[model samples]
Target: MSRHDFYENIRNSTRLNHFANLVNLAAIDGDIKPIEEKLLKRFSRKFDVSEENYEKILENPASFPVHAINLKTQRLEFLFDLLRIVYVDNKMDEAEEFLIRKYAVGLGFSEEQALVVINKSKKLFENNFSFDFYQHFIESDED
Candidate 1:
């Protein structure tokens, strides 16, 4: 395959893995609420996940492997998306928190970093701020 095509395939695979992670989070509480389902559908569209693949992922999200995002910005973006699903019901449960932490580590965060990020993200989401605001706050410490 061409270099460009190879890169595109990797990008697509990463998106699919991210989408599966979101699905896993949404269903972690034992039931996917209507609001959560709506958000998941929107995310699936954004990720360019076809209906068939979407269904397949929903059936068994854990079957997919986590793809580590190399860029810090992209990793934070993925974490933000996961946080959105967690807060969709207007409350964060223990299962959701644990799953998000696991995802954060899978996204290349150290355990300590994941704890800090997840705690800060919970507070930020409580304020109902935009992703831009969250991104700025999370990356503000960078030189």
Candidate 2:
């Protein structure tokens, strides 16, 4: 494989792993709702997760690695993605919050920082900022 292809594979793998982890979190709340399943399917397509790979992930979600994306923008994007997933069904349980907190750390934010980021992201969403528009808010305020 070319170097670019290799890196692309790594990035795709990282996305798939994180996606699976989020699904695992969703399942933790007893049952996976229809909306959650639909969002999961959409995310799988976005991540280029193959049917076989998704099946493997479903079989053993713990096997996937939560590899960090190096760029802050991408990491924040992932955080927002997680927020969207957990809240798509219009519900945010403690289990979902706990899982996102774990992901925040995995995304390179400290425990305290993660809470702040997550809350900010949630508020941004509440204000009708979709993911595409939300990045502008974060990017414009880089310290």
The best candidate by TM-score is: 1
Q: Scored by CA lDDT, what does every candidate get?
A: 0.77, 0.69
Work out the TM-score per prediction: 0.59, 0.56
Candidate 1 deviant stretches above 4 angstroms: 1-19, 22-55, 58-63, 141-143
Q: Write the per-residue lDDT of candidate 2 for residues 1-143, one digit (tens) a residue.
A: 99999998877766776788766755655576777666666657655679988777766665664666788888888887667655565556654566677788777777987787766665565444667777776555543
lDDT of 1 by residue, 1-143 (tens): 99999999987886787789778766766777887777678767767899999999988876775777788888898888667755665666765576578779888899988888887787688767777899888866642
Worst 10 residues of 1 by lDDT: 82-91
Q: After aligning candidate 1 to the native by TM-score, how far in Å is the CA of 53 from where it should be? A: 6.5
Question: Using lDDT as the measure, which candidate wins?
Answer: 1
